[model samples]
Target: MKKLLLTAGISALLATSAVAQTIGVSVARFDDNGLTIMRNGMTDHVDTLDGVDLQVEDAQDDVARQLDQINNFVASGVDAIIVNAVDTNATDAMSVAAASAGIPLVYVNRQPINMDTLPDGQAFVASNEVESGTLAAFQMCQDLRAQGKSGGAQAYMLMGQLSNQAAVQRSKDFHDVIGMDMCNFITLIDEQTANWSRDEAQDMMTNWISSGEPFDAVFANNDEMAIGAIQAMKASGLSMEEIVVGGVDATADALVAMQAGELDVTVFQDLAGQGAGSIDTALKLAAGEEVDKTVFIPFKLVTPENVADFLN
Candidate 1:
């Protein structure tokens, strides 16, 4: 009986060792709020699977770094490879490498523009960015109208990486959303891409203010930019209430500002679920379990009235 018990214990140890499948999860940049939430989700998912280990990589929005990371993951023989591309077109080589190595690749958040179709044994998931951008635009415009402002009112658009498919679609959706008859007088004074950097956004806003650009509202593409816009506002001797501030990706900081009446409105892109779902799907695919071909998280507008419910 003792011998049998020892054998059982040994089997259990072996089973434990076989759990967390090796996965290489990556993102374009770690500085953005949306990416942080997705990373959190991925880590949480990894924890749930006993043997599943997620190797998270931040490309810092550089193609070379991303390419190197992808190559390393392939060389390391990670069971699965995942990426949020820095340059969608440039990522073809990584996909090709993955195919040659027999490793499955998954693209998260941003879809590749150059790769018309994904290779077999690969999948993609993302938030419905059109809804997020439209909601953000709608909220900001409503707030401006509430202030009895309309027609020819200048606004500035601070945006994300132009190369990203999500960024491009979001920007397009924002313009479409704001193209209502009521807002015909609205003038987008400047629509420059910020690469979603807070410091860069601050510098741009400072320059715009210095140039005496006649704009009242600042529509930053992401929450980080909105926060940076706040710094710019303060630096420019303007209060938060001086202009209608809007953003996407409702991170904790942005939510706090909303509760404190500092920020006007934003859209919650539900970033946390991204990483977790990606891991779950990748593992399922590796294990020969069924998984969705495409999973898209939803977006919701966040305002002062709903902020309490959201926070709690």
Candidate 2:
């Protein structure tokens, strides 16, 4: 009887240990291409970790909804929380809530407006937006110059959501790079925000085509917008030979477009790296281990010549 009781106690303890390891993740929206890649990375890591349970919630691009989801995670006593914020500006409230509950918080993909305000158990994981934009700008200029159309060639920029930190940084970096003497020959004729929507970018590009403004190149902040611009340009009787186009995020669709000779260049953001980093950081924090306040995965430039390496 004594041996049986001891065995039962050990089983109960093991069950309690398994239940204690739970992580909650809140995504801004699952529909976004970049976020989708991140989600896959997160899912892959969760599958490998032992005794860790992960719960994911999609905020659908609503700040209030994201915050509420975080609150729910706190109430349920999750071991840690990973957030892909809808708005970086609202991170203060999120930080306060997570800190108050004594839960470690990890911000993935989208960065907050400021990281200084985060308490001890919070951190961020992503690539620098400046790197992606700078690489895209240099590649675009290189392609234009090679075609001998650098001087007096007009360029149009298709911006992502204006409020997103990545969009703002990428847009600023592109212009800053082009303003340099080497690329100054290229003129930015028109620029507009597509809010990172392929459909919206298509409509905007269609309007630009109807206006009859001659642009030699289109620089989109992401592959979705770049693909949209390509669709519009093709419908308007413009061929890839007549115009140069580039984008950030070497998503699968973008890579296909590049292979088909429809996209000239794209910058690769390491989706799997960021996703795995976020999960690792969250787990470390939960285990009372030290982690850097900000962790960055590097970005790479992808062109047809080297695109094959990134396809897998």
Candidate 3:
């Protein structure tokens, strides 16, 4: 009977070992709030899987460092690889390395530049850039009109990292919206790249304020920049009601800002959902299963009326 019991235990151990799969993940940076939530989502999802393991590394916003991490993952024989690109334009090397090694590669959050030419067993999982900026900008436009600024309004834009695809696309989205006849009353005073840093955005806004450019609105590529601009504006004694502030990525802090009547509009990018979806796609590709080349999680518009829905 003891021998039979030992045999059963050995079989269980073998079964667990056979099902184990390791995924290597490289994130653009660990300091960003949005990326932090997405990374946590990946780890939390791994907890629910029986025998899956995730090895995550931070690239610290360096393109070369991110590529080296991918190479190391490949050398280590990880079952699959996930990358949150530091620079969307510099992802071709990463794709090539993974494809040459016949390992599945999945990009999360940031859209890769060589997306159309990606080798088989590769996919991208993230919220659509078109929707993220459009939702936020359109909401801001409407808010401006409601505040009796339909006649004329000037605004400043805060851009994220120029190398990021999301930043470029989102900036285009804002321009597209304001060009429409219905929203044309809004004019852009100036736009500057804050590189998605709160402190940098605060400084930029302060400089704009010093120029005495009477602006009615501020558009930011992300919530961090929006909050930074708010801080600068408030410090300069500009009332929240005087300007319409809009941003993308309805992070926890952004939501709190909206609740406090500081942020006028924001778009929910479902960053955590993208993280979970990337893991699922990577596992599928690793197992030789089929998946869409691009998997897009939808973006949602957030405003004071419905901000409570996302606070949790």
Candidate 4:
């Protein structure tokens, strides 16, 4: 009787272990501010679910590395794969790999060039880029008016990588909003890509400062570039009172700057929401459940007055 009981117990334990699911996550780069926050969210969600294992890999902003990681995941027979693509244009290879393996692919944070090309079991989760730029522009105009310098406020734009969709959409939307008669008082003095890097943005700002041109505001597509611009301005003996600086992502450093009156404005992208939503959708797909092709979280404006709400 004792031998029979031991055999039955072993069989049940093996059955339970076999039912556990495994998920694979590939990030564009773990060092990115927003992507780091998203990764935390993914980890938190995975911890809450029983019998679900998460395998995470970072592509370090390399397309080849991202593809290699995806291939490995496919070979491992993971139930689903999530990717924060390094380059939106290079998603075709990723999609083919996941689809060929009959696994669901969920793209988070950075969106692909064409959503329609995603296979039936694929999906995307991100906040709209347009809202970030539009809100920043609106806030800039408002701050300018409050300072009693409404008309003809000179502005400089610090762009991210031109190839990135978030950078493209944010730049376009800012221009569109500024083109409206309500914001026509603002004039763009110059624009250049900083490649979404703090050091690069600082170098660009240093050059612009050396040019001796006067600008009322500096708008960066992301917080890192904005913070870089601010550092440059500070080193050049320019104060926040002389120039309004704004950016997206509402990153922790940016929030601190806002509180200290160093940053003028920022647009808050829901990083946590995007992260959790991606994992939830991926898990559902893994379980053979249906999910929407895309999930969009909204962006909000964050200024000094409302910065505290987002700090924690």
Which candidate gets the maximum lDDT versus the true structure? 3
What C-alpha lDDT values do all the predictions have?
Answer: 0.80, 0.92, 0.96, 0.90
User: lDDT tens digits, residues 1-312, model 3?
Assistant: 999999999999999888899999999999999999999989988899988999999999999999999999999999999999999999999999999999999999999999999999999999999999998999899999999999999999999999999999999999999999989999999999999999999999999999998999999999999999999999999999989999999999999999899999999988889999999999999999999999999999999999989988
TM-score of structure candidate 3: 0.97
Q: State every prediction's TM-score relative to the real structure.
A: 0.90, 0.96, 0.97, 0.96
Question: Model 2 off-target regions past 4 Å?
Answer: 5-12, 15-20
Query: Candidate 1 residues 1-312, lDDT tens each?
Result: 999999999999898877647999778888767788888888876776677787889998889999899889999988898888887667678778787887877778777664466666677777877888888888788888887787457788888888877778778876886688866666788888888888888888888889887777888888888888788878778767758888888889999978777778888877778777777777777776656667788888998878876784
**Could you give the C-alpha RMSD of every candidate to the true structure, in order shown?**
2.3, 1.5, 1.3, 1.4
- Candidate 2 residue 61 Cα shift, in angstroms, is 0.5
Tens-digit lDDT string for candidate 2 (229-293): 99999988898887889999999999999999999999999987898899999999998999999
In model 1, the Cα lDDT at residue 178 comes to 66
* Most accurate candidate by TM-score: 3
lDDT of 1 at 62: 88
Candidate 4, number of clashes? 0
Worst 10 residues of 4 by lDDT: 143-152
Q: How many angstroms is residue 302 displaced in model 2 relative to the true structure, after the best TM-score fit?
A: 0.3
RMSD of 3: 1.3
Residue 258 alpha-carbon offset, candidate 4, angstroms: 0.4
- Candidate 1 backbone clash number: 9
Instruction: Encode model 4's per-residue lDDT on 64-148: one tens digit a residue.
Output: 9999999999999998899998888889999999999999999998888868878888999998887889999889888888887
Model 2 clashing residue pairs (backbone) = none
